[model samples]
Target: MKEITSTMAGTVLNILVNVGQDVSIGQEVIILESMKMEIPVESQISGKVRGIKMKIGDFVNEGDVLIVLE
Candidate 1:
C-alpha cells in the first residue's frame, strides 16, 4: 500500500480520484489552498485508490495522509 500526503498545511480544495480508481505516479490527486494559492498533491506511486483520508474543505497539515492506495 501507498499513501499520498499533503505537502503543506492547507484546506482541501478538490479530490481528483475516487476509491477504486487507478492512479499513476505523479498524477494530481488533490488540490490544496494555502495562502490563497492552489497547490496540487500528487501520488508518489501508481496504484488503485483504496481510501480518501480527507474531503473537500477539510484542513490538513503537512505530512498528513490524504489518500491510501494499494
Candidate 2:
C-alpha cells in the first residue's frame, strides 16, 4: 500500500475520490485550504483507493497521511 500525505498544514477542503476508486499518478485527489489559499493534493501512485483518512473541514498538519492506495 502507498500512503498519500499532505505536503503542508491545511484544512481538508474537499475530497474528490472515494474508497475503492481507481486513481492514476498526478491526479487530483483532495483540495486543501491553508493560509487563505487553496492547494490541491495529488495522487502519488496509480492504484485503487483503499482508505480515506480525513474528512472535509478536518485540520491536517504537514506530512499527515490522507489516503491509502493498494
Candidate 3:
C-alpha cells in the first residue's frame, strides 16, 4: 500500500476520489487550504484507493496520511 500525505498543515478542502477509485500517478486526489492558498495533494503511484484517511474541513498537519492506495 502507498500512503498519500499532506504537503502542509491545513484544512482539507475536498476529497476528489472515493474508496476503490482508480487513480494515476500525479492525479489530484485532495485539495487543501493552507496559508490562504489551495494546494493539491496528488497520488504518487497508480493504484486503487483503499482508504481515505481524512474528511473535508478536517485539519491535517504536514506528513499526515491522507489516503491509502493499493
- Which candidate wins on TM-score? 1
lDDT tens string, model 2, 1-60?
899999899999999999999999999999999999999998878999999999999999
Estimate, for each residue in 1-70, the C-alpha lDDT of model 3 and write its tens digit: 8988988899999999999899999899999999899999878878899999989999999999999989
Per-candidate TM equals: 0.97, 0.96, 0.94
Residue 33, model 1: lDDT of 98
Q: For candidate 1, what is the lDDT?
A: 0.94
lDDT of 2 at 28: 98
> Which segments of candidate 2 are over 4 A away from where they belong?
none
User: Which segments of model 3 are wrong by more than 4 Å?
Assistant: none
**lDDT score, residue 34, model 3?**
91
Q: Best to worst by TM-score, what's the order?
A: 1, 2, 3
- TM-score, model 3 to reference: 0.94
Q: For model 2, where is the 10-residue window of minimal lDDT?
A: 41-50
lDDT accuracy of residue 23 in candidate 3: 95
Residue 56, candidate 2: C-alpha displacement in angstroms = 0.4
* lDDT scores in order: 0.94, 0.95, 0.92
